[model samples]
Target: MPIASEPGPGAAPAGADPVPQFSEWRKGVAGVLAKVRRVEIAELPDEPEHLLDETTYDGLTVAPLYTRRDELPEHPLPGAFPFVRGGDATRDVHRGWYVSAHFAGPDAAEVNREILAALGNGVSAVWLGAGERGVPVADLPAALSGLLFDLAPLALDAGAATAEAAERVYAALDGYDTASRKDIQVCLGAAPLTSRFADAANIGLAETVTLAAGAVARAETVCAITVDGTAFHNAGASDAQELGASIAAGLAYLRALTERLDIAAALGQLTFRFAATDDQFATVAKFRAARRLWARVAHVCGAPDFGGAPQHAVTSAAMMTQRDPWVNLLRTTLAAFGAGVGGADAVTVLPFDSALPAGELGVSKSFADRMARNTQLLLLEESHLGFVQDPAAGSWYVEELTDALAAKAWEFMQEIEAEGGYSAALDSGLLAERVAATRAARDTDVAHRKTSVTGVNEFPNLAEPPLSEQARRADRIARYGATFEALRNRSDTYLAEHGARPKALLVPLGSVAEHNVRVTFIANLLASGGIESVNPGPLTVDTIAAAATEAGAPIAVLCGSDKRYGAEAGAAVEQLRAAGVETVLLAGAAKAVAELEDAQRPDGFLAAKIDAVAALSGLLEKVGA
Candidate 1:
């Protein structure tokens, strides 16, 4: 049950003299920490803990520093029991992990063309959407017409029609020789729990279990079930929650399969799917912990020597933004790197333009698909990311995170078991309740700008042209920047109706140098809500009324330093009000607003760390947007 075993400070050879430089290294680290603490205390004397203390949504406290002094867990080598390092003992340095591309099609010929192109262009696997939102079940043959079964592995995501889709795909493979069929790898993707969680009306659990058993019996090289965690992850489950729910689902499948097959065969029949996010270290740790947790499950099921769980990592759809979607390329690159380094067997990087409707953002589907696949190719060929086994194996931070995350995930699995099981918990709404709480906390952080989402919340570019339609994602996961994107959509509507965007008049009360910083801050905040800022430069009280009138803005914000606010903001607010600026606001803290006479104080303050969504929403309403 030990997670890993490695030499550390305590593992020095018996009677071996301690390294003479050890004391010196400790002293050097202490000296650096002293200086850091002094600076932190000076900045936040009352709460300096904030400088070195951070906690993730999963409730894991991130230490500012980790060292050999930390009690590290003992893990076996890669491909060993518990498999924290990796499932495989070694991998081909040249080939690395599988590069999988996703294809969702309602047309058979079109999907066939894309599949062929993807395979020809370095894709090792194809994840086809086979029914409902994808290719019709009847068209599965045409969609897979020319696909060479032995060359490219196939993964099917058929939602409610998984049984029929799996049947059709199997039927297509009947023409191949038995040896060829054995060489073909397919994932039947029969995820009843994920499907039912995503939609209440999905197929029943007993039926799905029966179908999966039948498929496993019929399959040669097919994984009859996938314990997909993306539904919970997209629904705002934290990393630990996703892992726990997935394992619970996996266990449920194992139990069902054992009724027909042995434990080892059942274990081999299931694969796990997790979402890979831009949080690289967390993503890496999540994947590592998943293997450890699932390995423990197999060990307990009397299959101690079974290989670790096969993981398929898909870049998070929830993290993709509809605005400035080009940034998604960067996001997915980091995520793919995490997935690769964390030892995922296969990774699917959703196209950067995934949040936009096809062909609506001037990006062709073929171009986007090519970019997504090539991202992995470049990482594999150019960056050589997969040249090593268990790349993060020895890092103190990663190992400790992996251990702690596994513990937390195990606790969540226990909670689900206590609530009867994964299915029972989902039916009782326990899973949804927990996910909602986590989502609320995340939304609060985003709203207050504690979490910066580039191009949507921080450093927004209002001048960027709007998409022709509101952003549409097939998955329907709630994006982190959706609130800001909604505001942008409203601005687009206003612009199309009136040929111009709503504007806010910024009244600066001091010299440009004294007010420029606040001016920039206020302007960026306003633009994030799709409103433009019309700054008339540093204005005198006498000029404020005329500037507000000339700008013709219903809302005016005073931008200045605390000194300038005390000296000139009162007069500026009064003048702007006299000029019929319906809503007057200040750019500084609430204390600055209170320092003004009650009669002259602006309506509100736009200080750092304010609830940006609420503030922007109020401003948009006042500006008639």
Candidate 2:
């Protein structure tokens, strides 16, 4: 028989009242409250079901509570054959991950200066962007002039010109130490599949293959292939879709290269990059799950002992908002925490103003770049987040999420493989179709305020100045808050052209006690679209009409409790319509009002359940904004 552990300080004496478990506690509370309020806690405004149950896009259900019983699969130790916990038994041996940041300049000499500055600070690696916005092919020698090869690793993203860039880098490093060339870390970043959606040409496959073969022949440690998920992620692919697509792309490379090289050699020449989002736990699970799934793929490919996957995490650009870019610092901090704890080999935090275009290749402000680099330093030196390996290994929520995500991602990868692999899926439009569907659902949530985008969709700054138009470098990158930004932009245009901002009159019905809640709600909602709400407090029907006319606002929305709306909405609407109000809307849903006369019906409603983006757009047009 198993022994029962003795309870400590909080335990009740031997049989005083039995402590209630979660199930019993739930049932006992349900017995005391009415059926409607049972969904909510006694004093808290939130619904228990909403708080506890979450459904991911892959159809995985996250339980509110987890326990030992929820632990199903057993994970192996770190450095084991599967390498789920990372390939190294000792995680913190290298002092921490490589603090990396991207650099882009018109000329190689200018880039060289930025590189030196970055290294002199906290950055340990250089992520060089190559192409029209970065160093040109002819300037490679001058670009890498002052770099110490052994001290800092180099990862080059040359886009369509990866082959030429590789040759240039090779020539640049000609006089460096030959032994250091063998041991120094470098990634050529040849990504052909990623270029398909990134609007760049595909000149990498043949050249990368040739480079890989040469590297093997010369006994050089160089990553010739890069499987990047940021393109798909920024294009709005769900977590499973991103992982599946990345794995499928990796498999495609493995299949294409194995004809010329061994499986281990091909694996050694590859690296993978993933996006880290502000959702810290989800980001952690995503990285952990990606490693586990890739290991399984490697096992199937007959390279079970090929070591762990090399992950380079970049903070999600889709999560960055143009408004209140300062909030991005906190967002990147959380993402970095996830990346560090998730065991990324290298992590890059994009500057907070990444959404705002500074120039070609998205040049960041000097201060912004400093903040981005220092964020990693703080995580490593101050927070000590890098001291532990697989920090979430024992947590029930993370473990469960990791397992579920891995299973879903594995299934998705198999589906892609059955469809003739990554390239074929992209050509057949299946990949884009899947991503489009998920993007639509995500956009719907954002429009309905189901997904809160702080400083954009939620707590917007009505008076904040708009950012100047930016020349985007790539076509595939998607911004989730761009739609809301467009609405606010329209208001700015209206204000600038007419010298007066668009205004909405909040026609509140009934007493202050009945209308205050929705009055505040309507004001905030209008502010999100850069439209000011003119609230004259709780007013009588006649006075509300006069106020609406005096405000000269084309849009009027009724704000009050359902009971008050059902009682006085008809009279208020008739008066407002008589006062020349062109459009009338209600703050609450029509269904919430128990009874309504024909005159009480609004032209439309502006509730939380409606498509807020579309509704706001319509309202702006109605107000001639």
Candidate 3:
């Protein structure tokens, strides 16, 4: 496997199309090609290698151990210079974070019911996921009277508001007169460059932040201008890139608003949102790194203290796979755990049944909001992960990765600095290219088997039923937000442009049956998509038997799961071939497929326990039809 060649100690990658010139550098200075030494000896118990221990979000090759004592590019202190450890020595251990869940039903009464239920179930804040324009309080006083506990129902959007509408939202809530106004928060969803491509919207997120921060007396209440890191995460940003972009966004808003309201006061209301994906360490490292990164930016921006602002994290909708739906809970757990460990002020996990709604056109499904909300409560109370701080703190690998990420991100930031900064980089399409390249590389690795995801790429059951919308991206308000700068105002258009995608005929072979032919099946499947295959006929066993006989073989092909492909499976292959058939293929692996091969050799055989995609791709090649 996976090997770590002493990471880039000097120049660029060796095979970079046209190599960098290194004719006049010091010996071992810019052209050192350190030999990769895996084992001083592999049989030793003390030196067993772990493949995952050395990988990183940026694809950097890190050693098994790195530390503060290790040679690192030096930086300044926390809250003083570069702000690596953190900013201002203070950290939040306050009754640990609000569980903010978004809720929207058919109307106010229906919506109020969800809000009240959430408050009852421990959701401290409520985000009214896009499409509702006013403070959802129709008869606000009555709604408050009914609730045992008070809740903040926040609205979201990305556009300028008329003078009247803004006043109406404030008045509607004021008229409600709930004692919990002390805890109630309102956010004007005006995030900057949230939609850079939209030329006409007078939506200045910084302006809205200033307006609300200046007016509100509920010092605890937020007039938040969200900087969603999820947008960049889903678009394939490495943990460092995601953190840098978020820092820049927060700074952009802070630089604009500190002129009006004090910087700390404005930042206090800002919510930095991120997406928690399946890669737990990366997710954990992301939030912690984000905190450290933001702390630095805040210090540079002249804030005396740079901690305590809320970090809102949502489990990524992108990482949820449609193929083993139940495995989604495991994925969500890993991601949510990362968010919690990395110090999220709040975390939300999307239900296994979210995509059906987030992807709907015109009729957004509300299937998972309640489930998503409950996920946080389940973790907060059940898992009890709240009992620690920077949990992975000093572990050699984590620390190394953390420092490595900071340095790599700083390098990118320096380049941006040379080009006038983050906004300029985004405008020039540099950001998109960077994230896209990472995504393509990862996707290619997954497809090729270079990176094996257990239930996904490696051991997959071809006979298993295809998955539906049981799991999906937590519902995102599509195509708007600074993260959507490249995609805004054109989601539907882009979808239209790439319309009518590839169609695959998924053959669901019930648990196991003799009718199944694993290799030919996959090869045929692959062939339908324009790959080549080595079979013909009605995709039936009788036809396969006939072909075997014609090929002058005394064995036939039989394919099915272990349950069906027992010892008799070989016997049946022989019986069919005696009647003029020639090979047997078992979709199930393990000793069963091998046992059949040991019993007697068929002309050719291929078997798989999982991997419908690869199998199908292979099968498609065998039979053109």
Work out candidate 3's RMSD over C-alphas.
Answer: 12.2
Cα lDDT tens digits for candidate 2, 93-184 = 44688899999877778889888999999899889988764888678778888888777778988777777888887776776765656767
| Better model by TM-score: candidate 1 vs candidate 3 | 1
lDDT of each: 0.84, 0.80, 0.52
Clashing residue pairs in candidate 2 are none
Tell me which of candidates 1 and 3 scores higher on lDDT: 1
Top-scoring candidate (TM-score): 1
- The segments of candidate 3 whose C-alpha lies over 4 angstroms from its true place after superposition are 1-53, 62-95, 132-169, 176-183, 195-202, 205-220, 358-371, 452-625
TM-score of each: 0.92, 0.91, 0.64
lDDT tens per residue, model 1, 427-529: 8999889888888888888888898889998888887887675353234586788888888878887888889998899988778898899999999898889
Model 1 residue 421 CA deviation in Å: 0.8
For candidate 3, write residues 1-625 as lDDT tens digits: 0123454555346555223332232223212322233333333333232332565557566664343334344333333333333333343433344577755443656667767777776777655533234333343333333443234445354245422334445555655646655566566555555344223243565466556565445533645576777767677677777776676666667766776777767666566788887778777767767666666666666774744456778887766644334566777778887787766766777776454334432223344555566566676677666555556765656666666676676666666556666677678887767777777666555544455444444443233332223222334332111111111112223223444212222112234344345645554433222222333333333344455445442222445455555544555555554664323344344566465565553344444324334543443333222
**Residue 570 lDDT in model 3?**
57
Question: Candidate 3, 562: how far from true, in Å?
Answer: 23
Could you report the Cα RMSD, in angstroms, for every candidate shown?
Answer: 3.2, 4.8, 12.2
By TM-score, highest first, what's the ranking?
1, 2, 3
lDDT of 1: 0.84
